[model samples]
Target: MEIPQIPINEKERLEALQRLEILDTPAEKAYDDITLIAAEISKMPIVLINLIDKNRQWAKAAFGINFCESDRKHSICAHVINNPNEITEYKNITEVKEFDKNPLLEKLNPKINYYCGIPIVNKENLALGTLCVIDHKPNQLSDAQKTSLQALAQQVMLLFELRKKNSSLTKAKEELHKQNELLKNFAGTVSHDMKMPLSNMILTIDLLKAQYDKQLDFQGKKHLDYIKQASFTLSDYISSILTHYETDKIADKNNVEEIDVNHLLEEVIDLFHIQEECEINFIEENPVIKVNKIALEQIFINLIGNSLKYNDKNKIIISLNFSKDQHYYYFSVTDNGVGIPEDKKDSIFDLFSIATSVDRNGRKGNGIGLSTVKKLVEGLGGKITVESREGQETSFKFSIQKYSQKKTA
Candidate 1:
């Protein structure tokens, strides 16, 4: 038997085949179904979805056959890959001189005489192997059958491509998960280390202020105050970073509970010492929502805090309202604050976006709160959006799916 010569691009072809990771895999129904259809269409008793490896042709799918593999020197599939785009057919293998000593033909129990193979060529024009059919009697395929066989070969190539893509995506997801874990650990470590030093600094400053209260000049007291404020700001920034990283770890869960919107808002408001000048109103009747309570609390805290933080009005008028549709509960936090600029609206929800206007106290924003809120909302299967007119009123609207107890349970 004459051994089939390897293609000029044999090295690259073998690399591509290995990357597919299909060699020696257990039979899959996707490939078996194609071979079964091809067998039915061609009226052939034996059919195979072959993959040509470096030294052998492996059967990914086989019908009417027991063996899973064969040597390349004895494989007709190896010959088909050399002229991959064309179908190779032998009406009677015994009549062909080159295949006269072919081991496969000599070993057939029924003394197989007919063979046909359509090469499974990928988009790169490298044939991996073939979709082949064999018969025990001299036979010929009709033009339609040959066309259908070639189409099935293409389907086999498509399956290979899909398998490679899915494997790549799975690897990427695993890598991303590892990276996120590392980041979470890093954030926790840094936050803890930095907080200790900050606490010591704050304690030292307060002790110095108390001991030197009457002895200190105005400038000395003012500089000390500045240090205390700066330390507090740094503390806030670190806290925000810790919160953001922590939110990243909140996986989706079916932890839904009925929560009174009015009571939740009242608790969030109490957490922040609202300015006497700020006129915060819960406008309409609030709906009792079935939701992840922690996520809902986070949404209100950030939105209401921002409304109070960014306002330019003498009396910051903030209105909270809620409405609902069949699928979602829509909540709006509208504020007569210095509204979000049209250009900055899209990016305000992004991490570290410092799109702020001066509040009553003239404090600038650190820009982590809104992003944390966005993450929490999305984690609970909700979406948030903003509507604003520059220098007028800005409204932040968000929707969360009303939880169905039966569906979740």
Candidate 2:
């Protein structure tokens, strides 16, 4: 028998086939189901979802077949893929002189005489293989049956496309995971290596100003202050980065405990050391919660800290309230501070996105705290949103799901 001639774009066709990564895979139920349906609809005894490889016709799914594969030289599928867009049918293979000498003829138990192969073409217009029907008797498929067969072939190609896409998505996930790991490492390195030096620089600037206050001119003092501010900004930036990176590790059972909200609020209030006429209130009847206390503390700290820092008012009034439903505990932190602008509200929780507002000390924000708070809130299986009236007040409302509890006896 004459060997099937390769297409002019044989290299491209083979590359496309290999890209599918379906060659020699074990039979899948999805493909087998199609073959079975094709067999039933077309009244063919055997149906195959064949994939044409460089050296073989691999049957990924077969309805009535025992053999797994056959040599490419013996594949009628090779002939169907040659035209790429048309279905090839032989009413009687023995009557067709073209396939009379093929080696597959002698290997068939029932002496197969009829064949129809539909090209399984992909989006790239390359025919990877065929969905073929085989019979020993001289037979012909009706027009509707022929259409169904072709549609089934398309389904086969769709399955191939899906497999390729899922593989791509899996690879992307792995790559993303690797990137996150690297970023975590980089953040850690910056935190450890740069924090101390920045602190030292700020301290040196302070000492220089204090010791040489009389001798230093206006420009000299300004330069020292600039250095100190720069150091503080960089140090804050590094700290934010570290906190953001560490957020993923904080949402777990390790920190979950029975926490008293009153005590927690007291600690959070003390953190800011406001020596001004400021009021921070958290009044909850059921003050205790079984949850990730540390994560909750971080969320509260960031919000309250923002309330204190961004305020232009003489009296910073911060109110905190908590309520619980069956599934979640909701909290609201409202502050009479310099509220977020309407235009900037949408992106306030995005990393490195700033509203360009200076704090009470005239220090521009590092724009990391809100994003970290959002992460922490969502990590606890809840959502957070902000509502603000630019000059009047800003409120952060967030929910965290209740922790799973074992049923007590």
| Best-matching candidate per TM-score | 1
Runs in model 1 lying further than 4 Å from the true structure: 248-252, 357-360, 406-409
Lowest-scoring 10 consecutive residues by lDDT in candidate 1? Answer: 247-256
Give the per-residue lDDT of model 2 (tens digit) for 270-331: 88788879887777575688889889988998999888888889998999999999999999
lDDT of 1: 0.86
lDDT of 2: 0.88
TM-score of each: 0.92, 0.89
Q: Give the TM-score of candidate 2.
A: 0.89
Candidate closest to the true structure, highest lDDT: 2
After the best TM-score superposition of candidate 1, give how far the Cα of residue 102 lies from its true spot, in angstroms.
3.3
